[model samples]
Target: MLTDVKRTPGEKAFDWLNLIIVLVITFIILYPLVFVLFASMSDPRKMFDSPLLFWPKGFNLDSYVTVFENKDIWMGYGNTVLYTTVGTFINIMMTVFGAYPLSRKRFYGKGLFTFLFTFTMFFGGGLIPSYLVNQQLGIVNTMWVLVLPGAISAFNLIIMRTYFQTQIPLELEESAYVDGCNDYRLLYKIVLPLSTPIIAVMVLFYGVGHWNSYFEAMIYMSDRGQYPLQLILREILIKNEFKDMLGIAVDSQYADRMIVREGLKYAVVVVSSLPLLILYPLLSKFFEKGILVGAIKG
Candidate 1:
């Protein structure tokens, strides 16, 4: 025991109470995830009867098999993967370039350009007008429609510009300029390497947005084959007995499958989320630093 800092009995009791409070809060947040995992594995009938139980009853792979067997589900997964990867790449590049010039005070037409971009953030053409634009552009009824229309999100551009303004030192650009490096060279060699965290943050943001999109697909596409994962998942969740809008009958087996499909919905949630969930821990290291680095002073 050191003479300098002995704790009184009351102080020790407070520490124990704080530890208990923290553990309770942790359990409150985590219990729902744990419950979902249990429900997904448990027999559906048993799950309904005792919905709050902690353990599976008569656990089986039937739900997993049922979800996997749905052809649209697999296709949706494939489509989502392609959309997230391609969309994230395009998002990152466009945001970086857009941010770069806007960060500079001397760029020609900077105010006009910035106002134009920011203006879209607060307003937009109505849905019908936007659809007409997409149709005119020939992106409707095509895979590119899913990937292109809203490619450069305005909030992301503003964040990226703000980041560049606050974080990249002016002296670094001046140093590169003295070496006769072009703008592209300075950006690729100096700015991008130091901007990994923000880039990763943008990737997560845009990638998830693309993954979850359904409304644009609903209005713009006529082909079932072109439906993205969320639309397909919507069919599984809510369209079990509903006729196709074009007057097609819902297959009878589709109704029979709902018992297992309920569980499969949870399984799909796990599957749809697996990539981001796995990537998050890896990306979160960059994510935290990114938000902090540029925002602290600004």
Candidate 2:
């Protein structure tokens, strides 16, 4: 039988204090997102006039209409999806292959190899040299340039190697070997099947990175058609070059342009970030478990 334990007065007070602090912090963190959302939906003139930006100041959605109507926006969206899916797949594959060998006890020169991987975390060829190399390889404007170069992240590899070491037992491997399973067979058939949580965590990490990446695309891709969603959105935000998106005539009133521009400003952010927000909740449990599993024994 379990007994209920009573909290001390101090403990109860501390709990209340923590609750208040959490609420305050939550409000602080969420307010900007809320503000942006409301601003995006609000009538620009009314939104500015409102004293407290708690709600939409007379709902408007011309900005969203402007964003969605752009063929380039759709093209960039497709490109971002392609890049994210391909890049995350490559990241997971490379990380798994790199990590698995290191995780095995029989692997040769593990420490030196691990050190070399870690060394890359600190030192890198600066941008100009990297660009020259990519240019020389003739992949400057290619999909391969974006996905292949960043295939394996050293930090993620270490986490996965540690997870494999701690989570999968030596007895399991020995038993598999006794059954005449080769290393590749053991990995493909048994280890991978059991590593879903870590894999999901890796997916979220790499997926988000690819989804949000813009600088690399901007640097490597001169072809506007090949530009990722983030790079396209950056152009929309910074350059305000949405005349092509505007359904109105070029001579349409400046006031109409301003209204659409105001909404588009926040709409772009919402469109870019909404997928990631949805993705996180779906992977949250797996992410928590995988990260803890890797860290506890690491």
Which lDDT tens digits does candidate 1 get at residues 210-249? 8888888889879988788888877766775223211243
Candidate 2 RMSD to the real structure: 2.0
Local distance difference test scores for all models: 0.80, 0.89
Q: Provide the TM-score for each candidate, comma-separated.
A: 0.86, 0.94
Which candidate tops lDDT? 2
Question: Which residues of candidate 2, in runs, are more than 4 Å off?
Answer: 1-8, 247-252
If candidate 1 were superposed on the true structure by all CA atoms, what would the RMSD be? 3.9
Q: Where does candidate 1 have its weakest 10-residue lDDT segment?
A: 241-250
Clashing pairs in 2: none
TM-score, prediction 2: 0.94
